[model samples]
Target: MGHAICEELEAHGENFIVIDKNESRTETLRDEKFDASVGDISHKDLIEKISMPPTIFVVSSDILANISFTERVRKQYPNVTIFARAADESTKEELVKKGANHVILSQEIVSNVVYDKIKKLEDSADAQKLLRVLKETEEKLAIIVHDNPDPDALASALALKYIGNGVNVESDILYGRGIGHQENRSFVNLLDIELKKIEDTDLNRYNKYAFIDTVPDANNSASVTPNIIIDHHEVTESIPDADFVLIDANCGSTAAIMTKFIRELNVDIPKEIASALLYGIRSDTQDFTRNTSPADLTAAAYLYPHVNYELLKQITSSVISVGTLNVLGDAIKNRKMRGSYLLSNVGFIRDSDTLSQAADYLLRLEGVTTAVVYGIIEDSGIYISARTKDIRVSMGEVLKEAFKDVGSAGGHNGMAAAQIPLGIFDSVKDKDSLIYLCEEAVTKRFLAVVGAEDEK
Candidate 1:
């Protein structure tokens, strides 16, 4: 087992030394061009003579020898990282207590390999199921995304449409509300992804409907029952029944799930599709800084080589629009700070997406650990965008607990948003009074949930 590990390390071009108690075994390793020495690993004289690197690995056949070597090395070099092999759980625990930074168990490694294989098989089955459903579509298919669709939603919808095309089922990407973010608009225009407004499209023409990146809900304007639903958000409300539903809260983005399907089904990924999916994963995961998983990283890695870097740069570096700048100005001027929390009112705005940008910007303030920006739309309701770096707080839960009775709210731990219908607030004609009431109500509700209300 240790020889196999050494071969792998050598194949990866890593520098490592081997120690063995048997002189013939050490000579054999040296003859094979390995840095080998015949010495007892637990001997203080042997350890003192050898130059120790920042990391040491003790993977002998004997668990007792491994533990002794780990303890001796830790006592001599307290700062070095030690990886020790163990025979069982008890030996693993003993190695850890003796200051082994990592314990590698063959059984655990085998179990992980088995789990990965099973997961791959399950994913393949899911892909086949989705393809079967797409092939059954009589007329055209409608791949609808959430309102004001972001890159993740757009990419996933496009991936589904690509898959649908493979089975000769024509599909259209549909979205409710306008894409208000500058970067989102650039992504669509640059990629030449065709999308139709849900209000403008004839819903009756499509025989099959697939919702991507969002489930059927009151806010999404999903009038008809969906045949399919694929999403990554935590399911707050019970999902409406669908023929094929793949909702993985563990995934960082819906694009990652779609990437898995494309790979499992052996569909050739186009460069444009790869670029879009990679950007979708990056955007939704905040470049893997928030709510990311190994699946998301693996998906990104697979898509990276095929992505168009030039187009990606253009989409990500889109200039802020005049409306967004105006909103940011308002947010900065009206900022209110209480302890580590900062709240700002951007006043009435046509674009709600700018609120999140402003919240992200406000979170960079020196002392602020949590930032919230809110605004009201004319016919719509008050929109709230929140961001937090405090690991103790879940922004999603905070927003949900604060406004569950009055509106809809949910997201990841670090970022969340909410929308409350303008019920009684619509009657307030005075702009100043409306801003005051919105600020007071929003601040009190939000701060109360985070337990920062008592702070002056």
Candidate 2:
């Protein structure tokens, strides 16, 4: 294991030195062009003679010897990071008490390896099922994303399209509403990703349909039943019938699941696809600060080497549009505080994505534990975006209970969104009265659900 670790470090062009009591092993490492020395690692005289690096690894099979070496190193260099290997739990605890920064157990490492192999087999099976479904497509497959697709939705759609192409099946990436988010638009433009507006495209031409990052009952505009459904959202309702379903609420984003499929299937990820998936994971997880899972981080690490950093930078640093600025201004001006809760009404907006931006911004205010921003989208309806730093409140559940009968709403614990149809308010000719009614209803319901209705 120690030699294997050394090989990995060497493969990554990392500077490392190898020490062993076996002269033959030291000679072999030296012959392989490694910096090596034969010495008793526990001996104080030998340890004092060599220059110690900021980090050291002790991986000898002898548990007593490893413990002795770790204690000696810790006493000599108190601040140095010691990564030591232990054979069991007792040894690990003892090593930690001896000032080892990290201790890896042999049994734990073996168990992890076994678990990964089993997981890979399971992923491979799932990938094959998806391929079979794609192969059954007589004509082109239509990959549908939610309305006004975010980075996670867009990237997952792209990955499915890539998979479809691998099976010699033509696919078109379809979306409902316009991609109004500036950063999302930049992502599509920079990656040269091809997407067709569902309204403009002839949906009848496709023989099969697949939904990514969303389900049919969600806010998506597609009416057709999907053949394949992949999403990371918590399943709040009965999923529509589908040939293949991969819904893992544990994942931070659907992009992470897609990344796993790409890896297990051994598909060579294109630089554009890699970059998109990486950004998608980062965006949906709020840079791994919210609703993140081990799978999400693993996916990001897998794509890091293949990602196009320049394109990712351009996508994230997109210029905020005038509409977004106006919405932000309105949100700030109209913000109402109820204790630590902040709610804002942006009145009417051409782009609903700005609500989320406003909500995110408002959550940064001092002493504010939660922020909710809402805006009307003329003909569509009223859109609400919420953010919360309070762990006691699950924003998704709050929004769902607040608007259960009136609209569709659900999201992670930290962030959530909702859309309510205009209904009778669509006929209101007076704009001010309409805005007042909407504000009153939204604010009251939200506050009531969060148990802040009585708070001033």
Query: How many clashes in each candidate?
Result: 0, 0
| 1-456 per-residue lDDT for model 1 (tens digits) | 667766766764557898889899888899989998887876768787899886666877788988988898889888677778899999999999999877888665443343344366568768988999999999999998877788999999999999999999999999887788899999999999998988998899999899898878634666988999998888777888888999888899999999999999998999999999999999999999989988899999999999999999999899999999999999999998999999999889998889988998899989999999999987778989999999998898899899988887878788888888888686788888987898888999998888888996
TM agreement with the true structure for every prediction: 0.75, 0.75
Give the Cα error of residue 421 in candidate 2, in Å: 0.6
lDDT by residue (195-275, candidate 2, tens digit) is: 999889889999899999988967788889789999998868898888999998889999999999999889899999999
| Model 1 / residue 379 / CA error / Å | 1.1
Error of 2 at 434 (Å): 0.8
Q: lDDT of all predictions, in order shown? A: 0.87, 0.88
